[model samples]
Target: MISGILAYRNIQNSILNGVKIPHSTSQPLIFGENGKYYLAVFVFFFSREDIEKGLVERPTMWAVADIETGKIIEIRQTKNKEFSDASYKIKYNVRADAQYDTSKKYYEKAFAILDSCRNEIINTDRFNPEEYKHYLDMIVANIPKEYQRFYFDLSV
Candidate 1:
């Protein structure tokens, strides 16, 4: 069985390789469906130069990946009109910002797909909380202190 931490790393690497651009990813949220694990994360695209200048652009997108294979199943811009409808319009530039708004839908289409598949939010049977915490700590250590706050919340 794949551990949640391993799945998270695999998916993260897959996304990084696939994007081929400077970006930052939110903490992955893992779920299971049809006996297979999956993960969803928000990605903020920006240039490496922006980091040195302390000006990270905030164009956000979201992706879902198959944990076992680390293949991205779907990825879409959060501001894409194709995914937005009258009932679910894009009002926030960031997924984290949408999380607090009770009036608007956040990742409505992606969540619908998962819901259709009967996806169950999970942390995986083999998840080791202690190890995962250590992993996160290591990751945070490399990030500048001013930017470290973004890694703390995994609600998305």
Candidate 2:
């Protein structure tokens, strides 16, 4: 059985590897439902100038992944309705303060988007329970002994 954290890390790494973008930030959110693990990795694109200005751009792309197999299920480049408006305008003496405020809003939006995606996946019957279990078993069999202790059994 793989620990939840380990699964999350693997899923995040897989998404990051699949989507390559320089000077971008990512936030990966994980959740399990009906014996299946799913992840939505949101990637925010920004340039050096944007960072200097303490701007937090909306997520340009996002990928959905199967945590059990550490594979991307889908990638979306379309903008969501929540972020259709222009970003918030704020000024601060400290760059970090401005970044914090903007980043907080971006993360909140990311969470909302993930929740929406999760609802869709759960309601649409997108996952197969048997297949999820098979992938879990495969992960357990392949994981090294040294790493086993760190990963709690998910089967419990």
Candidate 3:
């Protein structure tokens, strides 16, 4: 049961520090799937008025990382229910080769289905802490029951 602060720190640090990416501005929701790690980086890009009024923002990105191998294999981005291109890379720490099937499999599958998972959250006009959790819950719920575990809210 990797939840609360430990799960948050593990996923966030592994992705941000492991992949050499800049630390995320806000918290991210982390969960596991089939021994691989996945995170939803929720972003609010609308105006202050919209935010104050509990409007959901656009451009939420879902990141899939191989934590055991310390690599970010894929990322899917969305803006106003539309898919956007995102960069995905294998960290230098993980050698991308046949010898590492467990890690490579996660990356490969993540890449293959990146498009289908975009814009998973549809409520763009209502954003709140509760809604955020609901969105994460929805994302997690969509995952196959056997491949899911350790949902947590993490802050940078």
Candidate 4:
């Protein structure tokens, strides 16, 4: 049985090894529901130096990995057009202003929970959509209301 954490790690490593171009970092969002696992990563194609210099308008890649059968069922990347220059500017301001510190802390907590429970999520013999949905609902209930919408938008 492939646990959610194992699935996340499997896909994350795949993206690190198979990305089309050399990437500096990958910030991942992982979720498990309906007896399935999802791994989503926002890939930044910037060097450490570029980020240090405050360049936030670079192109970003979205990688989604669907894990099943203890393997990656699907892995794909989508170029997000909504992250335009204006969006980057907003992101830069948000980072510099520290207004999202609370949000960041919450997200980090969620990630920690998922990351720490790898061994507990045993692999199942078959996919169970209802079971996953139930688990997903529980996960969603724990998130702050402000970030619930964003969490639901992750469809990978």
Index of the highest-TM-score prediction: 1
Per-prediction RMSD in angstroms? 12.1, 14.7, 18.3, 7.7
Better of 1 and 4 by TM-score: 1
Candidate 1 per-residue C-alpha lDDT over 1-156 given as tens digits, one digit per residue, 9 for 90 to 100: 344445556667876667577777765554344554566666666655655555554435667776444467977675772211212222222223212322224333333333323222343335444444554454444455544444454322
Candidate 2 backbone collisions, by pair: none
Question: If the candidates were sorted by their lDDT against the true structure, best first, what order would they fall in?
Answer: 1, 2, 4, 3
- Model 1: residues with Cα > 4 Å off, grouped in runs: 1-37, 47-49, 79-126
The segments of candidate 3 whose C-alpha lies over 4 angstroms from its true place after superposition are 1-7, 10-42, 67-71, 79-156
Cα lDDT listed for each candidate: 0.49, 0.45, 0.36, 0.45
Tens digits of lDDT, candidate 4, 1-156: 354545556665675566465453333345444655555544546555655755443335545555332244444444433322223333231023223333645645544554443223434333344444444455555543433334455532
Q: Model 2, 67-149: lDDT tens per residue?
A: 44436687666354221232324321113321132354554444444444444455674644444444334333333342222
Tens-digit per-residue lDDT, 71-142, candidate 3: 446554544332333222211111122232335455334332332222222223212345345444544443
lDDT winner between candidates 1 and 4: 1
Worst 10 residues of 2 by lDDT: 147-156
- By lDDT, the best candidate is 1
After superposition, the stretches of candidate 4 with alpha carbons farther than 4 Å from their true spots are: 16-37, 67-70, 80-156
